[model samples]
Each structure stands twice: as C-alpha cells, then as structure tokens.
Target: MSPSTSVLDMLSITPPGWGGVLITGAFATLFISFGAYLFGMTLGLFGALGKLSGIRPLQYALNLYTTIVRAVPELILIVSLYYAGTDGLNRILALADFGPIEVNGLVAAIAVLGFVQGAYMTEVLRGAILAIPVGQVEAAKAFGMRPGLRFRRIVLPALIPNALPGFANLWMSVIKDSALIAVVGYQELALAARVAASNTKQYMVFFLAAAALYLVITIVSNMLFSALEGYFRRGQRPVA
Candidate 1:
C-alpha cells in the first residue's frame, strides 16, 4: 500500500482485521478509567472521612494507605498487583472452598489503577471536606441533625462544588494511568498501538494515531469538566 493509503487504511475504525483494534483499545482505555475513577472515589470518600474521624487508629490507617500508595511508583504497583494480587485473591477463595477465580485483565486494570488513584482521591476529598465551614456542620449538629443527615444535606452538596476541580484532575490522571495497565497485558491504547506498529511496521502512523486518540479524550474531558464546574459554581461565592 502507498504511504498515504496505508495511513488512511490503518486509521479506519471499520472492518478489516487491524483497523478496529486500536479503536477498541481506545474504548478499553476509557472503560478502565471510568471503573477506576468510580472505585477510587468510593475509597476516597471513606478515606477522607476516616482521616477526619478523630479516631487515631483510623487516621493512622488511612494515612498509611495513602502514604504507601503515593510513595510507590505506579509501574511497580501495576506489576505487583497483576501477579501477586491475583494469586492472593485466588488463595483466599480457595481457603473459603470457593472456585478459583481467574482475574480478568480489564477488571484487574481497574482495580490496580483504582487502588493507586484512591490515595490521591483521599487527599483531594479530605481537603475539600476540611474546606467546608465548620460552622455549617456545627449548626446542623445543633439543630439535632444526625451525622449522616448532616453530611447528606449540608456537607455533600457543598463539597461537590469544591471537590469538582480535584475530581477533574483525578479523572485526567486516570485516563493517562490507563496506559500503565497496558504493561500488565490489558490491551489499552498503548498496547494497541504497539501491536499495530509491530505488525504493519507503520510505527509513526500508529503511534501518532494513538497520541491523537489520547489528545481527543483529554480535550473531550476538559470540555465536560468545564461544564460540570460551571454547573456547580453558579450559586457559590467566588473563590478568592
């Protein structure tokens, strides 16, 4: 194929065996990030609350969790989790007399990435929670609001507006981190590009296409985040 035709053909997301692979990889990247972000956020919400809980042990434990995850390199975490984590999980299942579970690559990718992302999310949420006016919470308490009610009615809403910027950053990081899991055999965009380039010897074309796809995701994410930030910012006092 001519250079122009080769580039054009490889970029096609339509039929022919190779064309759709990278496109599918791009979607897999998005899927992993979505799962990781949600999982991370769940861990983060609890971690943040634990840090602020005034229980020394809880604070210590969360501090350790975030500290360890943050201190390690992401590549190491991915490697360690893929090999050791799966084995450990299966071991536990075996002890429980349950069938051995094969860890799916996509699921492992999300879990590994989410495990790392959660530490960062913890700090982000803890700061957002701290930024909430203490008086507001106290007032709710004085009104006989239960802790759950106070958080649900007063804290969470206020936190959303403040938390969104941090969440946006975390989300972007998650998308990029999705590439890391490709090392662990998750056929995300990076892996997809590598395979295509390897097969076609069109290194520049496939790699650049992967770059463009990543940029597209980042751009789309920024636009979405801008809309969300605006939607939440409307009723708030201006950030100084």
Candidate 2:
C-alpha cells in the first residue's frame, strides 16, 4: 500500500471521513468569521456615526457599550452568552405560545462575535472618519452639496482608504477568534480537531492537521488583504 493511499484509507475510516469533516469545518469557520465581520461592520458604522454626532448623552452611551464589551474576555462572553441566550430565547418563545427552539452554537457565536468585534471596529471606523480633512467636508457643504451628497461623494471615499487596513486586521482577528466558538459547541476547525482526535485516538495527527488548516487560512487571508490594499492604494502617495 502506498503512503498516500494509506493516509486516504485511514481518513475514510474516520466517522466524519477526516477529509470531509476537516474541509467542512474549514468552511464553517470561514463562514462564521465572514458573516460576523459583515455584521460587525454594520454595527460599527452605526456606533461610529453615533459617536461622531457629538451628542453628549449618545456618545456616553455608545462609549459605555464599547468599553464593557472590549474589556471582557471573548471566550467567557461566548460561553456565557451561549447559555444565557438559549434560555432567554426559549423562554420568549414559550411565552409566545410558539414551539421551543434551540439556538445553534454557530448562531450564538456570531452574535457574540458581532457584539465584541463591533466595539473595536467602531473605533477603527471612527478614527478613519476623523482622519478625513474637516476642511474638505466643509468645502463640500459650501459647494451647495447636501449632507447626504457630501457623505457619498467626499466622506466615504476619503475614509475608505484609512478603514481598509483596519478592516483587514479585524478580519484576521475574526478568523482566529472563530476557534473560540468551539467552546460553545460550534464544531469549527478546533472542535472538529478535538472530535477527530477523540474518535481515532490520534491526537498528534489530528492536531497537526488542524494547525496546518488554520495556517493555510491565515496565509490566504494575508495574501488576499495585501491584494485588496494594493488595489485601493494604486494611485496614492505615502504621507511623510
């Protein structure tokens, strides 16, 4: 038996078919991270806008939201929210006379991710927005441009250059943090590794494979973000 064939046969013998489970787990991890990033972007945008509005009460509330979320450890938040979220939702459904429903770990993880990461993203976007020249915004307004038009034409274009790098960093963080979802029973890459190890009693093998898989993802993400940043920076000169 060839070495390659032996490896394949061993994988096939596993309950999840090592190849299938690992591949699926990778996708799941990516999907969870990506979905949460998108969600966080939306939440962060609102938070940034609220902060920038300069309303003292609103700013204080938004700041408090970010402060509490950022201070807490992500793993504790995920596990706590998973249990509390399930109970809270189920009770609401029961009260509504609807059938009880269970929240999937993936769903709970996404919520936790959005709550936590969105806080950080808010500051990133806020700083990006602040980096834009206030003079340009005033000039736009002076040009008879409406508030919406000024934002669409000047504000968005100006801040995007600053925001992209921050977004890339946030994206990478999300990918790594998705592993924590395993603690909540989301069965992502790390959880899959644990299961595969337990089933085959080949702890070293499965762990090494999981590590390789995560490394591949991180590498691919870095390359992708580099390409994106390059594309965005095509015509730009660096500031001194």
Candidate 3:
C-alpha cells in the first residue's frame, strides 16, 4: 500500500483511530511503570534507612544489594528476573500443592523494573538523607525525641527536597526502561508500536508516534516536578 493509504487505513475512525490504540498502550506503559516506581520507592526508603543505620551488618547487606543491582545492565536484569520470578513462583505453588501461577507480562515488568530501580534509588535517598544537617538530628535527640519520631518529623522533611529531583529523574528512567520489557512480550507502548509498524509496514511513522508520546509524558512529568521543586524552595527561603 502507498504511504498515504497505509497511514489513512491505520488511522481511520471507522476502525476507531489508531490514536486510541496508541493512547491505550501509552496508558498501560505509564501504569506499569508508575506501579514499579511506587514499589521501588518503598524499597528505596527502607534500603536508604538500612544503609544509614549504625549497624554494620545491615549497612553491608544494603551495600551489596545496591552494588549488585547497579553493576548489571538493566536489560539483563529484566530478562533474568523474568525467568527467575516465574520459576520461583511456580516452584512455590507446586510446593504448596497449588496449580501453576501464571506470571503476567505486566507483573513481570513491574517486578523487574521495581527491583532494579530500587537499587539505584537507595543511593539517591541515602545521599539526600546524609545531606541533611547533623545539627538538626542532634537537636531532635537533645529534645528527647525518639529515633522513629525524629526520622519522621525532622529527617524526612529535610531530605525530601533534595531527594525529589532524583526521584523524578528515576521515575522518567523507569518509563524509558519499561520499553525493554517488550522483549518479554509485554503489550506496553513500545511493544504495541513495534507490532503496529510490522503489521502496517509503516515502521518509521508508528515508531515516531510512540517516541512523541513518550516525550510528551516525560516533558509533562518534568514540568510538574519543577513546579513542586519551586514550591518547596519557596518555603525554604529566609524570612525578611
């Protein structure tokens, strides 16, 4: 088919515009990536705490996790995790005398991405935590504040501003990294675009459209983070 004809056919409203397919895929991509980010954030917060602990064993274990995860390429990590996760779950199910548990593409993508991103986010949050003034921590302790209360009230609030930028960047990376999940047959935006291109033989057009969608998501997320950073900074300003 001619380029114009192919484009028109793929985008025709009678079939419900390719726009809807693209949008649906984009939303799926965002949903899976964000779910991974939330999982990563939880892991990161605890990992950061572990790293910051005075206990040598806890710190050492966290250090190992960070080193091993960050040392490997994300694609390799994803593939390995996908196989291992599925196998492990199957093994557990069999042991429990349950039927085999199916690992969905989205679940695999989220698990692998979350695990990988959590490793890096640990360092990011730890650095932010360390950047906070020691004096403030000491003051909290001096005031007879318990460790938990001090962390929640004094340390966390101060660490957030510094950490927000890094977290936002990590979230963007998660979105981009999710593209690699296509290898595992995840029906994410990149996978959908690849299929569309192959079927329609308009590879460049479909791929370019996918790129534009990703760019839009990243740009919008960055703008929101920028506004948040500005708000936080304003509150940090010295009173006249």
Model 2: residues with Cα > 4 Å off, grouped in runs: 1-8, 11-17, 94-99
Of the two candidates 1 and 3, the one with more favorable lDDT, higher being better, is 1
Report per-prediction Cα RMSD to one decimal. 1.4, 2.4, 2.5
Worst 10 residues of 1 by lDDT: 10-19
The per-candidate count of clashes, in order, stands at 0, 0, 0
lDDT of each: 0.90, 0.86, 0.89
Stretches of candidate 3 exceeding 4 Å from the true structure: 1-9, 12-17, 237-240
Q: Candidate 1: misplaced stretches above 4 Å? A: none
**TM-score of candidate 2 to 2 decimals:** 0.90
Instruction: Give lDDT for model 3.
Output: 0.89
Candidate 1 residue-wise lDDT at 13: 72
Worst 10 residues of 3 by lDDT: 11-20
Model 1 TM-score on a 0 to 1 scale: 0.95
Please give the distance, in angstroms, between residue 144's alpha carbon in candidate 3 and its true position after superposition: 1.2
Candidate 1 lDDT, tens digit per residue, 68-113?
9999998998899888889999999999999988888888888989
- TM-score: which candidate is best? 1
Winning model by lDDT: 1
